[model samples]
Structures are given as structure tokens and as C-alpha cells.
Target: MTSAQICIMIAIIVYLIGMIYIGFRCSKKNNSTDDFYLGGRKLGPFVTAMSAEASDMSSWLLMGLPGVAYLTGISDAGWTAIGLAAGTYINWLIVAKRIRRYTHTCNNSITIPSFFSNRYRDEKKMLQVIAAIFIVIFFIPYTASGFAACGKLFSSLFGVKYLTAMIISAIVIVAYTTLGGFLAASTTDFIQSIIMSVALIVVLIFGVETAGGIGAVIHNASELPGYLSMTLSYDVNTGKAAPYSALTIVSTAAWGLGYFGMPHILLRFMAIEDEKKLKLSRRVATIWVVISLFVAVFIGVIGYTMSKVGALEMLTGSNSETIIVKISALLSQHGVIFALLAGVILAGILASTMSTSDSQLLAASSAVSSDILGAFRKDSSNKNGSMAAARITLLVISVVAAFIARNPDSSVFAIVSFAWAGFGAAFGPVVLFSLFWKRTNKWGALAGMVCGGSMVFIWKYLIRPLGGIWNIYELLPAFLIACAAIVIVSLLTPKPSKEIEEEFDRVAQMK
Candidate 1:
């Protein structure tokens, strides 16, 4: 095998060993369902923040976002990155403390579905079933995206078929997650977050230096059509630059709006110990996100500049997963240190994908076992049975997601965005209204979720079948419709019982 191949194989083996050992260590702490699902809710701010960010960012930060920046331009990078940063920061600030406090008061919800069932007093199993279904439905495509990323990485490194690579990826995820649960996943995410930060920063610095600096990059970019334009990339087919507008930039920036509703992400708030730590968690998580995103964008910019300078294209080709491989090849011309940096980059990619995928599995499992199954076995005696069902649910989800990964329709980054938008539109409005508004009844929550989620799927599948509507994003339409549905439905339905309204107020008032 080539030296690069050897390095990649060695790196993968070492990373896997570390992850497995960590999983075994974490399993020792798994004495109860809470411990398994939430790491005992004793996590400090640093671990909580980093773990949440790691789970949220995933391979999209390394692959899709960067690839878009590279293939498109710096303008696309700036808008999307800035938008995500702002949205995430607001989510951490606005939702973190409130959710953490309310989940505890609402009987220490272990999952998002549990939160809904309790919040709306969904005694009829309505919210519970709906929430669980949406979690499963939207999460399948989301989990598939992460698996696709791992598959792409494996094929690039090992010259293996995508199916074989996908199976291998699934095995690694299941092995660590099925054995260790959240503790194992969180520990590895913490370690991986550090690896990702260091590797990307090193690359950003080295790439810019090699490319002659930011001034040179901007100057080179300026001379190219639509390269420096923040509006939109020129459509070669139309042969005209699309008019740049504020609406375009705002829509791109709104990518961050999806943060509030992502099931895998909000579970972090529920896992943290108390509301007091939220301040520190927010600071740490925001810093990690900003730094990591900046590094990824920098790599894309530098990668494109290198290609413009007659370097081979790294972000494209049959082995697109090896975009970092291309960067490594370029840097290795310098010496052994650069070679080691390449190893770090590979580890970062693995870490990001694993962290994200494991959390998704956890969310799906919890939703089914605790919400859907628990709804049927209403007797309190079934708690153990419910938890056992959760474990079984995890296995099924992992297998199904792995299977789907074998036949990904698009890049991991693209699939993830669709999932993110679905979750955001469907759940974000519901959660926000439930917490802050007293009038949000079970019907309103159900309507909001159905309308938002259905609209997303319609835009994805149906809207395209008819002549395409407008250029507006699907999430924008779905989100607006969901908000309207919630307000209209809640007003139309009987007001929630006065007792339920008081209970919501009490939960909202918790420390």
C-alpha cells in the first residue's frame, strides 16, 4: 500500500481502539436508564458544551459546508457560516436554560417525545406517538447522511466499495453506542472535538500560509467572476450573474434557525445538570462552533485557491471524501509534520461523523421506547420493560440507518440540511410556543408538527412534481405555515384546562 494508505489505516485502527475502550469504560457507569441516556445528567459545562456542539456540527461542517464554499465561493461561505453562528448562539442563550429547567420540573424527561407528552399533558398518547413518529421519520434521512459521510471517507482511504465501507461504518457506530450508550458517546465526542479543533486550525493556518496569505486569496478571488460577489454565483447556463439581494443573504443566514428543533441537539439541554451552568455552556459551545466553522471555511477557501493555482482538485472527483486527502497531499510536500497533521484531519472526520450519528441513534431509540412504547404500557411497572425496549430500538435504528447509508442519494451534507430543516420547522415552533405560551394545546402541537413536517416532505417530493413554485426555501414556507397552524388551531380549539395552564407556568418558573 502507498504511504498515505498506510497512514490512514493506522489512524483508523488507533481511533477505533480509543473509541471502543472509551465505550467499555462508560458502560461501567450505566446503572440506570437515565445514566445510559443522559450520562447521569451530571456533566459539567465544558463537556456538555463540546459534546452538544460535536453532535450538532457532525460531518456537515467538514464536508458539505466546506465543499459548498469550495465549489461555490467565499460569499456563500460567509452568509451560511454567519447565519449558523448567530442562530446557534441565540438557541444556546434562549432555549438552553428554559428547557433544562422545565424538563426537570416536567418529571425529568429523558427524551424529546417525553417532553411533549408531559408538556401538553398528552394523556391520550397523541403527542407522544406523533413526536416519536417524526423523530423516526426525519431522523432516518439524517442518520443516513452521517453514514454516507463515513462511507465516503472509508472508500477514499481503503479503495473499498461504498456498500462495504458503509457496513464497516455502521459496525463501528453500533459497537461503541450499543455497548457504551451516552457516556461512551460523550467521552469520545469530547476527545474528538479537541482533535477536530486542532486539525482544522492547523490546516487553516498552513493552507493560508502556503497560499501566500488572505490578502493574496482575496485578491485572486476578486479577479474571478462571482468569486468575491456575496450575492450569488453566476449561472453558467444563464450566462448572467444572479442578482444578489438581501433576501438571498437572509435566507442563507437562516440556516442556523434549524438549531432549536433538532432532537439530537436539544437533548443536550435536558442532559445538563442545572440551569446555572448554562451560561458557561453557552460560551464554550459558541466558541467551539465559531472556531470549527471558521477553520472549515478557511480550508475550503484555501483548497479552491490551490486549485486555481493549478493544483489538482481535491474537493471533487470519484473520491470526494478525500478532500482532506488532497489537502494532505499538498501539505505533505513540506515534511513529516504535515503528514501527522493529515492523520489528525482523518481522525477529526471520523470523530465528527461518529459523534453525530451516535446521538441520532440515541434520540430515535429514546423516542420509540420511552414515548411510543410507554404510551401503550401505561402501568408504571413497565419502566424496566420500557428501557429494555429502548435498547432494542437502538439496535433496529442503527441497522436500518446503516442499510440506508448503502444507497445515499446525495452528499451527507445535503441530506443533513433537509433533515435539519424538517426538524426545525416541525419542532422549533412547537417547542417555543409550548414553553412560553399557555394556549398551546395538544391539538396545536399536533397541527404544527404535521403541517411543518408534511410541508417539508411535500416540498421535497410533491412540489417538484408539479411545476416548481418559487425559488423560496421549503423551510421558510413550512415554518410559516406551522406557526400559522399552531396559532389558528390553538385559538380554535378549547383552551387548555386552567390546571394545565398553571402547571405550565410552574414548570416555566423553575430554577
Candidate 2:
């Protein structure tokens, strides 16, 4: 094997070792459901912030979005970066503190769906059921996206079959998650986040320097038609579509909105020791996001430049997803240290995938246990049962995620983006209205959930094929319609009862 190939293999081994070490360390803390799932609700500001951001960014941050920028150029990137940034910022500012306070008031609910069920007491079971369904459905695509990254990375580096890579990634993730639960997941996420951030920065610096610096890279890129344009007008090579416009970029970036309702991410805020720590968490999380995203985007830009200038291309047995790996290999050819650095880049991708995938599996399990099962039972004596349920749920969800990730049909970017829109559309509006609106009744909230979620499923899968004037992404339309349904239905229905009002007020009063 080539030295570059050897470097990648070593990097993968180092990452796996680090993950195992962290998992072992956190295993002692996994003594209870709270410790396992919410880190005993006592995580410090840095761990809380970094773990949340790392989980939120996922493989898509490293692979999918950057891949798009590499293939499509900077024009398409503007919308994605802007929209995603806006959504993430607003989610942090709006929902972070409120959900932190509200979840604590509502019996200190440990899961996203549970928070909803507890918030709107009248629809406890229904909310939990719908939530579980949505979690399982949307989560598959998200989890699959992460798995796809693993598949691509392993296939590129080790000549493993894609399916085998998927399974390997799945097993490693499930091992840590089942053994350590959320504490394991979050603690490792913090470590993985550091690795990812450092790797990105290092790769970005070297990649730009090696590619004749930023000026030459931009100049070469600008030679492509509309490469520097804010709007895109190119279609896929098949000639079946138009180039994405500037609006497409915005819509793509608005992806950050999905964070508001993401179960795994919001759980971080709830688990912080107190509301006061939220300020620190927010600052730390945002900075991590900004720096990491900047580096990821830069990596893609550099990759595209190197590819265009004859530094890399499709090999006899390789493909697009392997481009980053190949580019790293090319860097390795420059020096043994550069080859080692390439391994770091590969590990960065692994870190992003594992961090996000572990959190997703845990969140899915939490929904099944704390939200779905716990809602139907009134006896608080079932804590042990709930914990057992969560563990089982983790296993089941991981298996399902691994299975779907092995499927041959889905595209990496599309699957991830679809699930993201599903989460944003289905829960973003409902969560926002529930927190801020006084008149948001159970029925209205339920309506919002059904309409928003159904709209995404329909538009994304059903309506796209029938194809007429519909070019808008499902999230935009679903979010708008769901918000409208909440407002209109809430106005028609009775306001929240006095007790519910008191609960809301009590949550609000918790600093």
C-alpha cells in the first residue's frame, strides 16, 4: 500500500482508540438513566457547548455541504452558509434558554417529545406517539447520512466495501453509545469536536498554501462561468435542470433552523447545570460552529481548486465522495508529515460522523422511552423500566440506522437535507409557537405537528415527481403552512387552560 494509504489507516486507528478511551472513562458515570441520558444534568459550559455543536454539525458539515461547494463552486455556497448560519444563530438565541427553563419546569422532562407532551398535558400520549414516529422516520435519513460518510471514507481509504464500511462504523458507534449512553456520547463528542476543529484548521492552512495560496485558487475558480457569481445557473451534467439560483443557497443554509427542534441538540441545554450557564454555553457553542464551519467550507474550496488544476481527479476505482480523501492523499505525497495530516483530515470526517451519529441514536432512544412509553404510564416508579426501555431503544434504532445506511438508493446530500427539512418543518414552527404564543392550545400544536410533518413527507417524496412549478424545498412551505395552521387553529380553539397557563408562567419565571 502507498504511504498515503498507510497514513489514513493509522489515522482511523488513532480515532478509534481515542473514542474507546473516552467511552471507557465515561462508562462509570453511566450508572443511571439521568447520568446516561442527560449527563446527570450537570455538564460544564465547554463540554455542553462543544458536544452540542459537534453533534449538530455531523458528517454533513464535513462531507455533504463541502462536497456541494466543491462540485458547484462558491455561488451555491452563499445561500447555504447564510441560511444555515441564520437558523443556527436564531435557534441558539431563541430556543436555548426557553427550552432549558421550560423542560425543567415540566417535570424536568429528559427528551424532546416528552417536553411537548408535558407542556401540553391534554395531548400527552398523542404527542409522544407522533414524536416517536417522526423521530424514527426523520432520524433514519440523518443517521444514514452519517453512515454514508463512514462508508465513503472507509471505501476511499481502506478499499473496504461500502456496506462493510457502513457496518463497521455502525458497530463502533453502537458499542460506545450502548455502553455509555448520552454521557458517553456527549463526552466523546467534546473530544471529537476538538479533533475535528484542529484538523480542519490544519488542513485549511496547508491546502491553501499548497494550492498556490488563496489568490491563485480564487483566480482559477473564477475562470469557470459564474463561479464568482452570487447566483448559480448551471444544471447537472444531464441537462435535466437549471442551475441553482441565489435563493437556492439561502434555502439550503436556512438548514440551521432545524436545530431548534432537533432532540439531540436541545437536550444539551436542558442538561446544563443551571440557566445561568446557558449564556456561557451559547457563546462557546456559537464560536465553535463559526470556526468549524469556516474551516469545513475552506476545505471544500481548496479541494475544488486542487481538483480543477490537475492535482486530483476520479481514479480507476474511485468516485466523488473520495475526492476529499484523494486530495488528502495528494497532500501526503508532498511530505510524510503532510500524509499524516491527511489522516487527521480523514479522522475529522470520522469525528464529525461519530459525534453526530451517537447523539442521534441516543435521541431516538430517548424519544422512544422518555417520550413515548413514559407518557402513557402515570407511575413515576417506572424509572428503571424507562432506563431499560431507553437502552433497548438505542439498540433497535442503531440497527435500523445501520440497515438503512447500507441501502444503495439514497444520495448522501439529499438524504441528509431531506431529514433536516423534515425536522425543521415538523417541529420548528410548533416549538417556536408553543414557547412564545399564549393561545397555542393542544389541538393547535397537534395540528401544527401533523400538517408540518405531512407537508414535508408529501412535498419531498410525492409532489416533487409530479413536477410543475414547484421548486421550493419542502421545509420552507411546510414551515410556513405549519405556522399558519398554529395561528389559525389556535384562534379558532379555546386558549390554554388556567393550569397550563400557570405551568407556562412557572417555566418562564425560572430565570
Candidate 3:
């Protein structure tokens, strides 16, 4: 390897070592699954805010969003960002404090599945079982996208086997997460969010200068047909402007809907030390998300310009997702300092994946060990074995995710989009109604989960493939279906029990 490559590798190694050290350090505090899964509800505002957003963004923010812009222009990426920014704010504004309060109020439920089961007073535990099932279903692909992103980063930048790099990334993530669980994941996410921010800023500045600055970036972008237009996309194959319909814009923007159901992100709300502090967390998270999304999208524009100026190689298809990595790789060629900065940039890519992966692993682990197995255990009072069971489940899930992500050709954006739709459709409506609608019963939540989860597959594979307007994103229709199911099912079924109703009213009154 060149000196530049060596320097970048060293910087990444140091960052990885530090992350592992944190896991080991935090492991001392995890005495039981409660601590492991929920950090004993001890997260402060800053950690809670940053960790939630960091995990939520994953590699999609750094790689996927920029890639969308790099390949298709601003229409898809911009609208999605707009949708996500609004979703982030609205979710924080309304849902965060409520769920935080409700989770604590309803038997201190630690996981989303558990919260649903606990929230509705599901006596047979069917809600928890089904919810956990969906978590595993959607989260496997979701987590795999993170692993796939890491593999792409390493293999594209260096000459290592994609599978090898993927495994190493998965192992490191599993190591830290299995060792320390929630605290380790959250702490690392908070740190990773900072790294992600720094990486974005560094790349933006260096990439812009390398590409001949902001004016040049805009000018070059404008030269391509529909490249800078929100209502059109430059079709590289046809070399013509393709109409970006209003319906398509709305469908793409519906990404915001997924925020309501994101298990890992919701857990942050539940784990916070104080509900009142969530207002502060909301502000921080919103501002950060808005700024991050803008920069991430614009980086693609900068990347396009950079390619034109010979600072970066032109990328196509899934390789477009590596735009940030390409920029960082180019940065490394400038010298030792630049190489180290490139390392930091590269680590940011890892951080984006790791931050999300660790949180997801924890969430999925809880879904199995705590929500599924723990519920079925005859001796539920035995806390001693729970942590071991949780860790084992965590390892199994990580391995499954790694295996599924073994395909180096897998598109990070495609995986994330599908998984995001799954979670949003399946859990989004259920979560909102459960928290906000006290009249919502277990039957309604169950129906909503099943309907939403099923519709995503049906729509994506069956309906959306029909071409024309049917090509709309599955999340919008699935989310709507799920919401309708919840409302219609809730009204058709018997109302919640008095005790459950009182609990909702009580939580609603919480300061």
C-alpha cells in the first residue's frame, strides 16, 4: 500500500480500537438484560439526541443519500430529505416525549415489541411475538445494509475481498454490541454522530475547493439536462429529462413516515433519563438532521463536479453510493495530513454503519431474547440467564445479517429503502395510535402490524412493478394501509380495558 493508504488505515484502526475499548469499559455496568437492553433508563439529553439520529441515519445518510443525488440528480434525494427533516421534527415534537413517558409508565418496557405488548395489555403475548418477528424480518436487511456499506467502503478503497471486509466490520460491530449492549451502542453512536458531522464538513470543503468551488459546482450541475431540477431527472441512458411527477415526489418524501416506527430510534426516547429534556434533545436532533441531510445531498452535487474536474473518477450504478469514499480517497493523495483526514472521513463511513448496526443489533437481540424467548420462559424471574441469552441472540442475529449482506453487489440504498418501508408500515401507525389513541386495543395493534408488514412486500413485489404511476414507493401506500387498519380495527373491536385506559390518561398527564 502507498504511504497515504497506510496513514488512512492507521487512523481507522485507532478509531476502531477506541470503540472496542468503550464497549469493554461499558460492559462492567451491564449487570442484567435490563441494563444491557435499556441502559437502566439513564441516557442524558445529548447522548439520547445524537445517538438516535446517528443510528437512524446509518450509512444511508453518508452513502445512500449522496449516491441518489450523484446518480439521479436532486429530485429524489431532496424531497426525501425534506420529508425526513419534517418527519424528524414532527416525530420529536409529538412522539418522543409520549413514548418515553408511556414506556416508563407501562411497566418500564425496554423494547418496542415489549412496549406494544405491554402498552395494550396483551394477555397472550401475541402482539410481542408478532412484533418481534417483524423486527427480525425488517432489521436483518436493515442491519445488512450497514454491513454491506462497510464492505463496499473497504473493498472499493483498498483491494481486500469484499466478503472479508464485510465480516470484519460485522465482527467489530457484534463485538462491541454483544459486550456492552445499549450503553455501548448509544455512547458509540453519540461519538459517531460527531465523527459523521466532521466527515461531512471536511469532505464538503475539500471537495468544493477541488471541484472549483460552489459556483462551479452549481454551474456544472446545471449543464446536464434536468440535473438541478426537482421536477425532472437526467436519464443517463437516454440523455434526456424524465418527468418527476408530483405523485413520485410525495411518495419519495413519505420516508418521514418510517421514523415513527423505527425501533432503535424509539428506544432512545424510552431510555432517556428525563422526558422534559426531550425538548432539548428534539431541538438538537432536528437542527443536526436538517444540516446533515443538506450537506449529504449537496456532497453528491460536489462529487459530480469533482468527477468533471478529474478530482474523482466518475461513478455509476451502485458504485455511485461510494461518492463520499471516493472523495476521501482522493483527499488522501494530497499528503500525510490529508491522508489522515481521509482516514477520518473513511472512519465516518464506518461510524455511520457501526452506529446504526450496533443499535440495530441491540434492538433485534431484545426482540428475540427479551420479547420472544423471555416472554415464553417459565421462570421469567430469573434475571441471571437473561444477559447471556441476549448476548447469544445478538451474536446469532449479527451472523445472519453478515451472511445476508455477503453479496457485494447489493445496493445499500435499495436495502435501506425496503427495510425502512417495512418498519414504517408495520410499526409506524401502530406506535402512533398506541401512544396517542387510548381507545386502541390489542387487536387493532396486531391487525395494523400484520397488514402493514404484509402490504410492503405485496406492494413492492406485486403492485409497484407494474410500471408507470404504480412505481410509487411502497412505504406511502403501506403506511396508509396500516393506519387505516389500525383505526378501522380499533373501532370495530372492544375498547381497551379500564386499567389500560387509565394508564394512558396518566401518562398523558405526565409533565
Candidate 2 C-alpha error for residue 53, in Å = 1.6
* Count of clashing residue pairs in every prediction: 0, 8, 0
State in Å the error of residue 201, model 1: 0.9
Q: On lDDT, who's better, 2 or 3? A: 3
Give the root-mean-square deviation of each candidate in angstroms. Answer: 2.3, 2.6, 1.1
487: Cα error in model 1, Å = 0.9
Location of the lowest summed lDDT over 10 successive residues in candidate 1: 314-323
Candidate 2: residue 186 lDDT (0-100): 87
lDDT of the candidates, in the order given? 0.78, 0.77, 0.91
**Which regions of candidate 1 fall more than 4 Å away from where they truly are?**
234-240, 314-322, 333-335, 379-384, 408-410, 464-469
What tens digits encode model 2's per-residue C-alpha lDDT throughout 81-103?
66666666777788888988887
Q: Would you list the rank order by lDDT, best first?
A: 3, 1, 2
Backbone clash pairs in model 3 (N, Cα, C under 3 Å; residues 3+ apart or in different chains), count: 0
Global CA lDDT computed for model 3: 0.91
Give the candidates in order of TM-score, highest first: 3, 1, 2
